[model samples]
Target chain A: MIEFDNVSLRLSAFALHEVSLTIMAGDYYFIMGPSGAGKTILLEALAGLHIPDEGRILLKGEDITGIPPEMRKIGLVYQDYSLFPHMTVEKNIGFGLRMQGLHHPERKKRVDTLMKKLGVGHLAQRAPLTLSGGEMQRVAIARALAIEPEILLLDEPLSALDPIMRDFFVDELRELHREQGLTIVQVTHERHEALNLGTRMALIRDGRLEQEGAIDDVFVRPRTRTAAEFMGFENIIPGIVSDAGGPDCRFDTGTVSFSCSTKAIKGENGAVCIRADDISVREKTDPGTDRDNTYRGKIVAVNPSGPMVRIDVDIGLNIVMVMSRKTFESRHLKKGSEIVLTVSPDDIYIISTGTPDTTCS
Target chain B: MTSRIKPDLCLISFALVGSTLVILILLALLNITATQLSDIPFLLQVAQDSRVTDSILLTFTAGLNAVIILVLLGTPLAYVLARTHSRFNNIIESIIDIPLVLPHTVAGIMIYLLFMQRGLIGAPLKDVGFIFEDAYPGIVAAMLFVALPFYVDTAREGFEKVPLHLENVARTLGATRFRAFSLVVFPLSIRHILNGCILAWGRAISEFAAVIMIAYYPMVISTLIYYRFTTGGIKESTAIAFLMILASFSVFVLLRLVTRYVGRYDDRV
Candidate 1:
């Protein structure tokens, strides 16, 4: 486990602002933000590479703020892999062990096991420059893991790989977490990687922690409009809380009235959040479906993504919804076609007024 | 395509000018060596002379020793200059380049005053039974005086080319600062360091005025050649000069081959 307690660092032209985070044991934690959002700075602060200007860092319940990176028992890998080019793959993997004063036989055994696990054993004798990007990344991972540190910090680990390679690496990382039970805190700007492997994620914006919780909670129920937008929630409808109660709450947007799930006080101004995938399109006369919230809108665009079709509907406010391609074909939806949209009250999240609602282009 | 023999006029002109300058130097060296071709036996005999052989050996040994010292002292200095960002670093770097601009005779004079018997360093060093005036130590000191900048500058470039992130990664992998540099940086920048050593050694071996002003008795190859030219006439000096050329050429070739092998992994890092 790692804890960043109000850690602040001031680098020239960039900084980390009182950032605090807690990563649990065996947690595949993700720090998600746009590029230049100081996400990497936080990761480095945790690694003790950059001494914080403000707070303390506790590792395994002990203060490691004063410890140097070499003594911190942390492993970090970069997007470029940053493997030692002068050493062969085997030597590169074995460097940390040799640095730890491990004897030759023991070092060899450990290195061989790691290389075999990472599927880079055949590249042991080859120079790093000769290996592909994935191979080099595997070697770098082996090298970092050879030291057997308490935590592994990755800075955009899969950003340098092709799409296919990135997918493969993501699966490998999931397997690595499952099999080794290593606590990994990786930082990336790609939304899918965070959504895929992160057990817990913290969304950062302009050096501020916007939201932090389980991945499903943060994604389905973002705490702020900015957090919702960052997490790819495209439908944010402005509304005022008319009736706030236990099971269902009534919201009035001056254009339409809907029921959502919330605990806010009555007369509280807020916005309703809905994920694109949570909205379904149907005919206006479908009496068999007993949806709690329904609205009529005109389809503005029909975009196909793989086997799914995404429709942008203007139901007073533009809301994007996705459905299967087969459903789209059977319904015979097209641009300029009028339809009704249905969403469950559980999928509707309310963000109260006075919370920062910033959006980035 | 129409002309079937289109010439790159700008490139042709540049090549012509460059080749002319290079050919002039090559022809001058070949001409000198060919003029003494008939005197090969005479040159061999002069090479067999104790004074001639001793001066050549002394030059090589002193030059190599100077380069070794440069490696020990200049590497850290170069690393600091490359990594540190401040006005003070800039001033110190400019001061290091002073030896390159100052005339060799002026450097020799400065070193002479600094290492003379009554001089500040010389007096203290003499108290410890080591003298620099008219001694082998003075020869090496003079060579080091004018040749240190090449090694430091070249090595500094090498250090700058290595990204600091690599060392940081090494530290995260449980390597101390010194360990990371020795294992990662030193090996990666070795080719450039070797290049610097060759340049520094070459400059030291070819030095004449500096060595003559400080240690004229234990003549280096340069000093011995000048002495022979002045007193023993052109014929004897030419034979010795030709022999020195052969020795220098052989060493340069060997160094080039070593540098070539080392360069194979240069781009990899």
Candidate 2:
């Protein structure tokens, strides 16, 4: 396990403010944040590149805070691959082994094994500059893995590739993790990539850890407005709990009321985060749904984005819902169309409660 | 057709004006070669002359030694300057470039004051039997002083062209800072380093005012050519000048060919 105990760092215009996180052994942890959010700084800190000014970094319960990167036994791969242009593919892959003083025969064997495993054996003699983007990425990964690091740190690894290549490498990385049982820490801004690959994840904003937990908990139940916004929670309704005695509560937004499940007391001020895909939309004439958290609204906008369509409905309050293009086309939805929207009580997560003045608005 | 031909004519005129200096240099070299070739026996006699051969050899050896010292000392400074960004580094960069703008005579005077016998550095060294007065050390000092900026600036440019992340990756791969630089940064910047050495050696060998100010004896080719011109008229000096030119040209051509071969993988980086 790796643990970051309230780490704080200041680098020129950017600063990480007492951020803390943990990654267990064999866990694929993804760090997600917006651009300039200090995600890469946190990853580099874990890799021993940046020494923290305020806290200790523990590796497997041992304090390794002041250790240098070379002795940390952690490998870092950048998005650009950063393969040495002076070396050929084989040499680049074997660079780590050579650095560790491995003998010729053993080094060559390890390099050959990694090259064949990563499917770049045929390009061993070719220089990095001559390789394709995918080829260079594999070579970089192989080079990192040749060290047999306890944890591999990747900085936006798939962001540099095209969609097709990204999917291919995502599977490659998954298999590598499973076959080798290697702990991986990836930093990216893409939410889907994190959801697809991460067992645990953390969301950072403005150099602070907004939320971190198991993948299902962080994604399905974001703990703050910023975390919810980043996790694609399109409908964040701030309200005061009007009736809260049991697992179910009536949340009043002054304009619209929602029955959501929460553990807060009555008169608590908080917000309910609901994913766009969780809210179901239907024509007003099509009935058979219960009226627990249902509302009548008019479609305000329809945006078709490749395979998905985003619809904005104004039900006294604006709520966004995403559906498949086929579903949208079959429903014949358009602007100014009357529609019924239903959201399950379990799908709504309450957050930012207890502090009345600091409630999200 | 007329409109297209007008631009072509304008371009040709521009090319002709721009190539005037090149044309003049070629014309001068050809004129000297043609004149010297007509008197084959006299040219052969000049080539066999001990003074001409010694001066040429001295010039090359001193210039080469100065260049080697510059590479050893200037490379670290160049790499640091390339990778660092600060107000102090900017000040240091400006100081390194001072030699480039100084007049050769002024530079010669500066070298004379610093390394002359009983001078600041020369006085201490003189106590140890290392004299800089009309000696080989003085010749090399003058050459090194004038040629430092050429090597530092060119090598710095080369180091700047290499991305920093490559070295960072190497460090993570279990290499220390020095190992990372030697394995990754040095090989990538070799082409620029060689080019810098060539430029610095050329500058060192061509330096005349400075070498003469400190060491007129053990004459370099430049000093010998100047001396020959002062005592023996244009005809006598021309022979030594022709031989020096032939030797310098041959070395430069060979160095350029080697540089081309070494820099074949330059564009890939």
For every candidate, the chain B TM-score is 0.95, 0.94
Candidate 1 scores a chain A TM-score of: 0.92
Question: Fnat of candidate 1, please?
Answer: 0.77
- Per residue, candidate 2 scores C-alpha lDDT tens digits across A1-361 of 9999999998878999998899999999999999999999998888877899999999999999998888987888998999988788999989999989999999999999999988999999997888888998999999999999989999999988999999988998899899989999999999988888999999999899999999888888888888888988888988887777666777889999888876666777789888899889755576644535888999999999999999999999999999999988898778998888888887888886565432222
Docking outcome class, model 1: medium
In the range B106-125, model 2's lDDT, one tens digit per residue, is: 98899989988779999999
Model 2, which residues run further than 4 Å from truth? Answer: A237-243, A265-270, A283-291, A357-361, B1-17, B27-42, B266-269
Best by TM-score: 2
TM-score of each: 0.85, 0.91
